[model samples]
Target: MPNSPLHDWDLAPREAIALQKRLAGQVEREDRLDPVGRIAGVDIGFEQDGAITRAAVVVLAWPPGAEGEFEPTTLEIVEQVVHREPTRMPYVPGLLSFREVPAALAAFERLEVRPELVMVDGQGIAHPRRIGVASHLGLWLDLPTIGVAKSRLCGRHREPGPARGDWTPLVDGPDDEVIGAVLRSRVKVKPIFVSPGHRLTLPTALDWVIRCLGRTKLPEPTRLADRLASRRGR
Candidate 1:
């Protein structure tokens, strides 16, 4: 069983925003974990039927060196929950965290191995309020997490170099207080938006994401979770 109390379709825009604001204040930044152990990736997919949500969580052991790669084994532990309520909230630019977190949390509860850190397929503190889906989940679980979004959400930065591994800081404003980094994980591939979700710093988040990049554009955990979620929906 998972710990999700509300469904995606059940929340109104105003109610969801208020709930996020309430949760944002509860974030405990002092107890962040330094992830030297296992790591997990979480993603959610909705069935075309629009009645069911499938959440997938994939765990991969860490500490892979420069040449090492992530060979994630699908854990047998998996769970699915249904939300019969219709999705009332329309797609909004900054409020996506509310749309996805419920299903993500459901999948996370079924993980047999607790990961020291989690990477979500969305934004983190790089968001307008410094609270994206990754940040929201980190606050709820009190776990160190990072947001590895496929597209740029907010902020400005220089384009990374043509070569892989080259990166530039993502500044939140003219003062140059770095909120995250635009990392070139793979050559000729679009850079991923990496931001600290909770407990960890931007530098640490970038290092972990870079290390986890295997033979693909996305990190192994996120890639695997995405695959599973997409497949399960079919």
Candidate 2:
């Protein structure tokens, strides 16, 4: 069966903020995942210069090792889905999920195989309301998800060591609470932000993303999805 609506999508910024706060408390921060055999990557974008919201989801086999900057030889893609719809709402600074997640959920609903874990190209608990695109999608799908974002949406962090796996904690608030980690997926390329979206801890999120890295700055699953969604460079 297709996924039902998690909440009303047609929302004002204020309503979205309140909904984010309500959903944020529902996100599980502990490792409570089944044995992960398949992983999915999500990429959200726009088409026709913002008239359409496009979402891509790519499912790949798991256990691809964290090798150096070389494409994985055994990376296997099992499924992929793309969903596009009219842009729902204007972009709001702290309410990105409200603008992006509806299409993502549609893409996931169209997927043939349900991935055990998901990696999203956006923030997770690192958002101001602790509910970025990844976290919001996770709540809707009830799946374990990790935010493998190219940039940090919130929190401050020291520079991670310029190596394949070195990472630094990304902290927020007065207490300096650790929300995520900044990771260098490649030796010299830009680092990525890794945060647990749902049903996983921050450390577990980092481990899953590291496990999927292959050659590029973005991991295999996400890289493919981004390329698919953007219809551009790999």
Clashing pairs in 2: none
- The worst-scoring run of ten residues by lDDT in candidate 1 lies at 75-84
**Native-vs-model 1 lDDT?**
0.73
Query: lDDT score, residue 152, model 1?
Result: 84
Clashes per candidate, residues 3 or more apart or on different chains: 1, 0
lDDT by residue (1-234, candidate 1, tens digit) is: 144465443567777777777776665444368646778888766666655666677776665433453322332222322222233344587788766776676666665668888898898888776788899888877789899998888899999998777888888766766777898878899988898898888878887887777767888778778888777433
Give the TM-score of each candidate.
Answer: 0.81, 0.92
In terms of lDDT, the poorest run of 10 residues in model 2 is 64-73
The C-alpha stretches of model 1 lying farther than 4 A from their native spots are 1-4, 7-10, 25-31, 49-51, 64-90, 174-176, 232-234
What shift in Å separates residue 36 of candidate 2 from its native position after superposition? 0.7
| Residue 96 accuracy (lDDT) in model 1 | 82
Error of 1 at 202 (Å): 0.3
Top candidate on TM-score is: 2
Candidate 2 lDDT by residue in tens digits, 33-133: 99988989899878898999889888988655434434564667888888888887888778888888888888988888888999988888999878888
Error of 2 at 92 (Å): 1.5
Candidate 1 TM-score versus the reference = 0.81
